[model samples]
Target: MSIKSTAARAFAAYVDRQTKRWSRRPIKSQHKVFQNLLKVAGNTAFAKAHSFNTIKTHKDFVNQVPVRDYEDLKPYIDRVVAGESDILWPGKPLYFAKTSGTTSGAKYIPLTKDSMPEHIKAARNAILSYIYETGNSNFVDGKMIFLQGSPVLEEQNGIQLGRLSGIVAHYVPDYLQRNRMPSWETNCIEDWETKVEAVIDETLPENMSVISGIPSWLQMYFERIVARTGKKVGEVFPDLSLLIYGGVNFEPYKAKFDALIGRKIDSIELFPASEGFFAYQDKQSEKGMLLLLDAGIFYEFIPADQFHEENPPRLTIGDVEIGVNYVMIISTTAGLWAYNIGDTIAFTSTKPYRVVVTGRIKHYISASGEHVIGKEVEEAMRVTVEKHGFIINEFTVAPQLETPAGELPYHEWFIEMDQRPDEQKIKEFTAALDQEMRQQNSYYDDLIKGKVLQPLKLRVLETGAFQQYMKSIGKLGGQNKLPRLSNDRKIAGFFENI
Candidate 1:
């Protein structure tokens, strides 16, 4: 082995030791995080407004600081944007991570110097843990490409503003700078399709060993590569061994990915957001990711069912139960106090605290009393696809409230299938999907038995239905994702029009 490989392995071992120091004491780490956040940020305007100095316990915190979302917290953020120091956190934020999910145009999430390095550290340790476990540090010698947003940033007042991914590009360690791909000029190209084309041209002949990005965006790059080279992606880049993905669940895209790669490659899932890096898959054998309790952020959870109540109980890590879906709340060094990040997650293991992203707070099918989440639908798709060897490109579920004269309303599943089935097969597929849903959700089963709802219906769209929908809305690539199901027909209507 080369000196660099030896050095990398040594560092990975060190990180493993350091991680265990905190991971083994999960509750203690969180307690320290809570105390540190309150103590350091007490002098800030937001802390004072929330009476942080008077808070002693979690109970005190809940009483002093009510949970808030972007719209609720914007008054202080607006001041920070206008060049106010010590408004949120101490001093001005080093950068504002510009994002959008709100009805209110662009969201600017602050990134302080203290919180910024944690992003880099968590990302680095994810890889290090993999390397230490598998003894595969040689990939560090080859090219590593992270298909991300433009690095070019805009200055709002004095704080730099850009997408979180783009802002992260500026902080990559010097050692890996030479191994990172897609030239700066290519990454700066405004359009995603053009950027992918430029990326393909640059890395086609290089020794690429790692590829990372949002799976849907990476799918476009893979298809383009196959079309151009007339070879599978694995054959084109034989050294590629790792596929790293975040943003959306990767299960829906796995069949297409296997077809494109022509082989099995190890994959890692990460749970990160503009607010904070929450978890990363640490073991190849495990089902969920390792939650970060000491990442300069304090986590809280409200039972998903009780989330909309005027006064929902906020539980800390010690109080969370496995398999119970909870809407995640967080307070961080970046100065977001009791902020709801809008994600729903379920704990797979609370021994050391690991969680799986279940769905979005606003993204679910609950037209009736039956509340169907993203995890249930994704699981249903997986089992059905395994039983019947059909390939699905993408799909979403919505309630069909309108019905014909004698028909009962049912769920309408809009799917873009890669392999078309005969009418008999489609009937079987739809029946299987309905059965899975009923098995997973008791309320849905009761509704079916009582005749309040009919069996779910399937509507197969053309091959590129989802791609067309995303492109139509100018969200075709770069960290964009479709929710598995919606309570309304906003997305379903798009497919209906087509």
Candidate 2:
């Protein structure tokens, strides 16, 4: 083994030892985090408005601070953006992680000096966990690439503002700086297509081992690489061993990734957002991630079923149950208290507090009484594809409330594939998918049986249809995720003309 690999393994051992302390005693760690956040939060303007001085316990916090989304917290965040100190956090945020929003136009999430390291440390340890578990660390010496947004950022009132990935670009550790790709000039390209091309050119001859990005964008990059080199990624970079992905469920895309890579390699899933770093998959053999309880963020849970009610029962890690959907609430050192980041997750292990991100709170189809979520659709597609041998590039579902005269309403799925299914095969594929959906969500099954809804219809999209749609919206790159399913016709309507 190389000297660097030996050193990495040693460090991984040390990290695993330290991580055990908090992971083993998650409830205690969370209580300590809650206390620390409460103590420091008393100085902020949000705290003053919410009666933070009088709060002493979790029950007091629940009464004092109601759950608030970005819109509810915007007033305080607005002041922070205007160079006001002690508005949200104790001082102006070190950086504003600007992200695209569905209802809110643009959201600027704060990252304080205290909270920034949480993001970096979780990401670092995720890789170290892999090294320690598998006893393989030689990939550290090879080239690593993270497909992301431009590193260039804008300034607002002396505070740097950019995509969270771009802000993180500035903080790439010195040890890995020499091994990271593509060149800075290539990464700064404004157009995503051009950037992907440039990135391919820069790394075509290098030893790329670790690749990370949102799965969809990474798919586009991998396709481009194949088009250039006329070889699978595994053949192009024999050393490539690990993939790190987040922002969406990777299930539906796993088949395509496996085909492109031409072999199996390990991958790590991360639950991260502009608001906070939540979890990372610590074991290659496991599905869920280890939730970070002591990472400068205190967490709460609201059962997803009761989330719409006026006073949903709030839960701590101690009260959360396995397989029960819950809306994740966070109080972070970045000064977001009782903040609803909008993602829903379920605990897979309560002992160490491991969770799987299920879906977004707002991004669902409940147009009819049958609520369908991202996780269900993703799993259904995965199962259908595996059983029927039909590979898909990308897909999304939207309700088709308007149908032909006298025809029942049904769900419409826009599917993109490199290889077209024959007419009869298409029929079989759709039927298989419909059956899977019916099995996954009982409400959907009842609707089909009751004749309230028709079986879902499918539309085959041309190659690159989803990518083209993303580009049309000026969100072609950098931390952007295409919605898997929407209640409205926004994405569905766009697919209609195509």
Candidate 3:
């Protein structure tokens, strides 16, 4: 009966209607999106170089443009940075989302005026879809705290540069800005410890209804708040109804978060990246997010197992099969043609296509030929948590390539513990985890049976080791996460001295 509630209901309904319409015929919608993207950027240098003008259909476009990663497209990006027009998109990008690169220093992904709206739309619709599905619009009357990166942006070649969350922060709609916290000044504090302290000061007493951020950082906030108030998160903010999270899997963090909160709150997962907003949890009953077919991006999927092939088969919405892991490829309004974002996902439903992110292409461990991915590692951790009755605050695994004197090479796990178990318990935990991983990955099982790899080594990290490492790298929060598994010990080495 309240005006605000009525307005929210209307908005949610409209978003639901639009989402249903777009998802009703996913294949056709994707085809139209692809054709439109090509038409919009047909005059750009990238399009011309890739023979976009001659492309009339999705198949034609795929055949013409070869898939490229960030490294392969660096030259064109440099040209764009040097103030070139129509180099990638129609004009220059509004900003660049600066993220860490797998093999090197940094990656600057373009965020164009044409494509930025898609990100905004997807973020808005995520909440609206939740509202529509749950009929819980009462939260609209309360505050929503979004734990994001610093709002302060740096200019590069006349375009802004910052983390994707920071760049997106600049575009927060005026209406929502009233209920969003902390203040812009507090958000600019780069140090995670200092920023979190400032956020607690600003928001501890507010009428908070929703909290949105990467789960790890959000967990940090919850821990800080609980420590200060000597109360559970639910006790501190009883009105809190929803937790929106992305950037990492929530399974490993679920139990820990629930224990901290003292009660269960509804949660929604999102699939967003610097490249584009791809999917959102549209229905409460559905485990996977509904892919945004009508977003200003065209999608292709290459089977993950074959992604390394020179000409691996690329399938579109029409041909992709459910349950098959595929590396996502995109040609977007930002003018990235057949760009591989390095994320691997599998479709859970094909009728109105939905997907769950499987893992990252580069974030895997294959030491001793036992290829272990993020999903497998997270599952192992989940089982370890359940069996040991312990909680892990953060963790990463890397290969110990050099054996100690006369031992076999094995995986080393550096874990930050929420509740440290005794030595015997830790040993039992590692054994259970190793067994679970071997059960999940046949290659790993084979390696263990053949005596080629030793049992996993566990290293307990200091309370804030992961935070300190992230802070040292200037990636303390907002979409940045420690790689779960790495082929090298670069990350493990950082924590060794700490």
Tens digit of per-residue lDDT, candidate 2, span 391-438: 799999999988889999999999999999799999999999999999
Give the CA lDDT, 0 to 100, for residue 430 in model 2.
96
What would you estimate as the lDDT of candidate 2? Answer: 0.91
Q: Tell me the lDDT of model 2 at 340.
A: 96
Question: lDDT per residue, candidate 3, 1-498, as tens digits?
Answer: 667877888999998888888799887898888878878887889888888889887668768888999889999998987888899889899998988886757888999998999999999999899888888888877888989888789898899999898888888888778988888999888877898999999988899999999998999999999999999999999999999999888988888898899999999999999999999888889879989999888899999889888889988888899888899999888878789898899899986899988899988998677878888888889987887778788899999978778889999999988667789998888899899989878999999899899888899998888889998887777678878889998999898877
lDDT of residue 183 for candidate 3? 89
Clashes of each: 0, 0, 0
Ten contiguous residues minimizing lDDT sum, candidate 2: 38-47
Model 3 lDDT at residue 191: 77
Instruction: Provide the TM-score for each candidate, comma-separated.
Output: 0.98, 0.99, 0.96
2 versus 3: better lDDT goes to: 2
In model 2, pairs of residues that clash are none
Tell me the spans in candidate 2 whose CA falls farther than 4 Å from its real position: none
Which model, 2 or 3, shows the larger TM-score? 2
